[model samples]
Target: MRDIPVLFNNKDECCGCAACYSICPQRAITMSEDEMGFEYPIIDKTKCVCCSICIKTCPVKINAL
Candidate 1:
């Protein structure tokens, strides 16, 4: 698969939800613990297939254009 950019907004609005993490079939999204001990979603670009699953699963404004 080709390389794809996976970026997240760390605006503290993300509530450690696993929607994006669970929906990824390629196991691309990994949960990382923050200083507050909350699991945050981190995408592994190398493993990502550019399917945009995480973007679809994300409840936030992942893309507004």
Candidate 2:
């Protein structure tokens, strides 16, 4: 089976809107410090039910699945 990866966009593409985080009903998404010094989103798989809410809310094509 192919692994469903939790992808992250590079800092330049991230807008730090937290829309993905807000949309996740499982609260699996969290804001982290991007390398470029901006807040960006990361998935906490432990809390993620793989419902794909974060993927849908990513405005910058952050989701790879």
What is every candidate's alpha-carbon RMSD to the true fold? 2.8, 3.7
**Which residue pairs show collisions in model 2?**
none
Score each candidate by Cα lDDT.
Answer: 0.74, 0.70
Q: What is the lDDT of candidate 1?
A: 0.74
Off by over 4 Å in 2: 1-7, 62-65
Which prediction has the highest TM-score against the true structure?
1
Cα TM-score of candidate 2: 0.67
Model 1 TM-score on a 0 to 1 scale = 0.74
Candidate 2 local lDDT, 1-65, one digit each (tens): 33333545456556788888888898778788757678777877677777766666677764433
- Any idea what lDDT model 2 has? 0.70
Query: Pick by lDDT: which candidate is best?
Result: 1
Clashes of each: 0, 0
**Once model 2 is optimally superposed onto the true structure by TM-score, how far is the C-alpha of residue 25 displaced, in angstroms?**
0.5
Worst lDDT run of 10 residues, candidate 1, spans 2-11
- State the lDDT of candidate 1 residue by residue for 1-65, as single tens digits: 54464446564547677888899999988999879788888887778888887776777645442
